[model samples]
Target: MNRISARRGGASSPIFARSPAGSKRTRARIRGAALIGSLALAGAAHAELLKFETRPDGPNEAVVATVKLDGTSHDIAGTLAKPAKPAKPPSGAKALLIETQSSDDVKPLALERGLAVLTLDVAKLPDKARAPALRDVLGHLRGALKMKRVLGRAQGSDADAMTDAASAFDGLLLHDANREPAAPTRFIETWGADAYWREKPRVEFANGAPPNGRRFYLAGIAASTTATNCAAPVNARPSAPALRALFAALDEWTAKGVAPPAARAPLDADLAPAQDLKWPKIPGLPAPPEGARRVPKIDADGNEIAGLRLPDVALPVATFTGFNAQKNKKGPPCAAAAAIPFAATKLDREKNLDPRPALVERYGSRAYFVATVRVIADKLVKERLLLQQDADAYVAAARSAPF
Candidate 1:
C-alpha cells in the first residue's frame, strides 16, 4: 500500500489526525465547515422596519403596521425591497407615488419591475377622517401659491409644506427653490374627469397621484386599457403622440404661469429637460410609462390585457406581429418567446450576451427576480391561468368579477 499524508481544514496540521483506522480527513473538514456556517447564520438578523411619520391630519396618518419577510400581506409597504443600488430620482425629480384603489400588491408587480412605486392605501383611511384631511392639504398648497405671488417669494416653510405634502402623497416633489419650474403646474386630478362614467376605471387610483393634486393622473380607473384602446376610436386610447402631447401641454402650462391650486409653478429653468426616450413607434403597441417600461406586453388580440411582450425580438416591429400557428404549421412561440432574445448568445451574426450566471450575480437581484418571475409566469401560463386565449381580453375589462 502507498503511504498517504493527511491534512485538516486545508492545513498541514494534525487536526485531521487519522481516526484510529486512518480514515480520510474529509468528514472532519465537512463538519467543521458546517459548524462555522451555522454559527455565522445564527448571528445574522433581518433589518429593522422603518416607520412612516404619519401625521394626525394626513392620509394613513394613524396607520400602524409591520412587515415580515416570510409572512405575506396585502400592504405595499410591507413588500418593500431594499434598494439594490444607490439610485436617486432624476434631478429635481421627486418620488413617483402611486395612489390606486387596487390591492397594493397588484400595482407593485408593475412597479417592482421598474416604474417608481409608492402605493397609497386609500382603504386604510378611516371614513370619518378622510374629507377634512383632504381639504387641509389642498388649502395649504393653495395658500403657499398665493403667498409666493404676493411677496414675490414664498416663505421657506410654505415651500417646505408644499414639498412635504406632495412627498407625503408620493408625488414627485421637484425642489424648485432656485431652479425655474420646467412645466406648468396644471392639475390632473383623477376624480373630476368625465372618463370615469364611460368604463370601469382600470387605472388603480391607489397606484397613482393623489386625486386632489395638480399632477397628470394616468387615471387608472378610467384607462386601464390605454395600451390596447390606443388604436380603438371608440375607447379613446392614449396614443404615443397623446403622451408626448401631455408633456408638451405641461411645458406650455408652465410657460404661461397657469398654476393650479394644488400645484406651484415658479420657473421653467428649475426643472430638468425632459429626455426624448425612444418610445415604441409601433401603433397599437402597449408600452409602459417611464420607470415602468422594463418589460411591456401587448394583447395579441385587439382587446386589452395585462401582458408582457415577447422579449428580445431580433427584428423589431412597431405593432403586434406574430406568425400564424395554423398556416405557419409551427408551434406557438408565445410559450418562451419573451425570454428567447435574452437567451441567445449570438443573433443575426452579432455577438450577443454570453448566457452566463456571472453577469446576473454582478447586477444584483433585479436580473434574478426578472428571470425567476418570468419562469414562474411561463409555468403559470402553461399549466395554469395564462393560456386561455381570452384571458388577456377578460382581464382588460375594468370591473372585478365576484366569486
Candidate 2:
C-alpha cells in the first residue's frame, strides 16, 4: 500500500521528483557576500566630461565622463543614459546614480519607466578619494546634464562610499548595506531577502542591525552563484522582478516624493544563534556551523519565516536557507545559501526519515502549485514588491517546470 515510497527526484531534478539521500542529483553549491560601512574620504575634485553620443547598436544616448583620483591621474569612467531614442544631454530629468556595478536589470528597468540612468564605476575608485569624487560627479550630472533630482545606488562595501557622499543625491537605494545613511538624505537599504549576516549574540543582524524603518530585503545580486564546497543547491530564487519593483519604488520616492512600501524582513525576534535555529531533521542534510554567526529562524517545514518569500519560498517544492554549511564541516559556513527539495510523497519521506513534508503533501497537484504562485506574485505586484511582467514570467515558468 506504501507504493509512493520508491521514486525520487528533487526540485532540481528534471521533472521535480524526489531526491534520495544518496543521490548526487540533489546537491547544489554556493558562495556569498555584501554590506555597507563608513570610511574617511580624501582627494581633490578632478573630473572631466569625455564624450556623449548614441551608439549605433543602442537606442539610448551614450554618456562618458571621468573622475580622476586625487593623488594619481587615474580616471574612473561614468555613463549617464536617458530612457529612449538616440539623443543628447537631458534637461530637468530625474535620475538614478549608480555607485558600484550592479545587475543589468536596474538600468533597463528604470529606463523603461522613463527615469534617466547614470552609472559610475565606484568600485575602481581608491578608498580615500571616493566621497569627494562622488560629490564632484553628482555636481557634473546636476549642473551639466541638468538632472533634476538623483538617487544613489550601491551594494556591499561600495554602499558605504555612497553614504560618505550621501548628501549629494536626493535619495539612495542600497543593497546589502549594514548601516542606514544618516538622516535628511532619505534612504532605503535592501539586505537580500534570502539571507543576512549576523554576528552571533553580540549582533542579531549584522546587516541593518538595529532594524530601521527604511530597510528591507530582495535588493541583492541579480544571480546567485554555485561553488565547489557547498553542501546543496544555492538558494537562487529569481529576484530580478523583486529588484525591479524595488527600484521603481525608489525612483518614485526620490523624484515625485512618493513613499515606498514598509520594510519587510527579519526583526529581532526572527533571528537566533546558528545552533539554535529550528532546522528540520532531513536525512543527509549537512550540519550547520557552530560559531558566532546568527541566522534567520525557520518554520516547522525548515524554510525561513520572514522577508520577501519569492515563488520558490512561497510555493516550495524544496527547502532553502541563507547560509549553507561547508562540505569540510570544520570551516565556517560557505558564503551562500542552499536548496534541497522535498521527497515525492508522505510515504517516501517517512521511509527516508525526512522530517520535512513531501512535495505531494504540500502541493497535491501541479494546478494548485502554479495557481498559488500566481496568487502570491499578484499580491507582490499589488504591494509594489514585484513587477507585473515579472509576475507573468514566473507563472509561465511554473507551467513548464517539471511538475
Candidate 3:
C-alpha cells in the first residue's frame, strides 16, 4: 500500500503506515489515525473560516476561502456567500450550494435565501480526472462543514463529470450540452431545440446502482447551452426564475426529507413557423453556409423558444435574441445575444423594421403598461415560474420604464 499524507491549517502528517502482516501495533496505529482524522474534521467543521473581500467590478464583498481536497493534496479555490443572518438550515441536514465553474450568477439569490453559496473551479484538472477530483472536493467539504446535503450546478461537458460525482451529494442540478441524459438517471428537457437545449435530471444511481446512502433527488432544471447563459446579462437571464423555483423546492425536501413529486411534463416553446422564414439576402454580406442551424426563431407573438419567459419577454419592452453572428468566421459559432431597444416614440416605431407598437399602442398609456406587467407577474407567480420577490421587482421596474 502507498503512504498517504494529510495536511490541514499549514500542518502536515503521515496518515498511513505500512506494517508487517498480522502486526497488532500497526493495526492499532491505523485505527487511531482514522479516529484522529475524523475528530480533526469535526473540529474544522465548527470553525467558520469564510471571509469577505471586495470584488474588483463591484462594491459588494465576496466570501472567499481556500479548500484543500481531502486526499489529493490539491488546493481548490472556493468562494462563499452567507445570508445577513444564516437561516437555521434543515435539522441534521447541512446544505451546500456548489458550482463547478468559477463564476456563479445565482450566488446573490442563494445568499439572500440564507444558503451558503460555494463556487469551485476544477478546470485545472484534466478532463478524465475531474470527476474523481470533484468527488474528493465534495468529501472534503462534507467533512469540514458537517454537511449532509449538497446541491450542485454544472454546465457543458462538465455536466457528465458532475453526474458521476453526484454520488457524493444528496442532490445535483446538471445542465448538459445537447447530450441526452444517461439512463437510470431520470431526465426531462424543459425547453429549446433538439440539437441545443437543457436537461434537468435527478441522478440517484451510477451505472444502475446507488453509490451512497443518500436518497431523494430533488427538483432541478438545466439548460443545454453554457450554464452561464442562465444569468449572465440582466435582461437575458431567464434561468434566474427557474433557479429560484428549484431552490424553493430543494428547501422543502431538505427540511422534510421527502422527494418532490414526479418531474413536470416539458413545455414545447419552439417557434415552428420562424424556422421556415428566411431573411432577405444582404448585398454586401455573404450568405450563411448550407446546413447551418437557424437561430433567433420567434413565435408569432415574438418570444424566443426554450427559455424562462421573464417580464421583459412577457410584457415586451424590447426584442432579445440569445444568439448573434460572430464578427469573424474563425470566431465562435454564435456571438452572445443582445437586447435591442424598442422604439419608445411613435416616429421611431414607424421607422423600425420590427416595430413594437404594443408598448404604446396596445396598453394605451404608461400606467396601463405598468398595470399589465403586474397582471403578468401575478400569473407567473401562480405558475411558480417567477418568485414573488422578483415579480414585484419586475413590476416596479416596468412602472419606471419610459413607456
What is the alpha-carbon lDDT for the whole of candidate 1?
Answer: 0.25
Q: Tell me the RMSD of model 1 versus the true structure.
A: 25.2
Better of 2 and 3 by TM-score: 2
Better of 1 and 2 by TM-score: 2
Evaluate all candidate structures by whole-model CA lDDT and list the values in order: 0.25, 0.60, 0.48
Q: Mind sharing the TM-score for model 3?
A: 0.63
Runs off by more than 4 Å, candidate 1:
1-89, 92-98, 101-116, 131-186, 190-403
Judging by TM-score against the true structure, name the best candidate: 2
Provide the lowest-lDDT 10-residue window in model 2.
Answer: 28-37
Predicted candidate 3 versus true structure: per-residue lDDT over 1-403, tens digit per residue? 3223345466655433333346654554454334333212221221111111213223332332222333333334555554455556432345677777755455666666556667766676565555665664566456444566676667666666666665555555554332333333322223322222112322212222122111211111212233233222222335555556555655555555544333432223232333464433222222323332433345443345344555767667754443333445564443233344556676756665444554566566888888888998888687665679888988888877776
The residue-level lDDT of candidate 2 at 7 comes to 19
C-alpha TM-score for every candidate: 0.23, 0.75, 0.63
Worst 10 residues of 3 by lDDT: 212-221
How many residue pairs clash in all the candidates, one count each? 30, 7, 3
lDDT of 2 by residue, 189-269 (tens): 776533344222223344552322266644222224565577776766665666678877877776666788887767777
Superposed by TM-score, candidate 1 places the C-alpha of residue 321 at a distance from the truth, in angstroms, of 26
lDDT of 2 at 125: 63
Model 3: lDDT of residue 217: 16
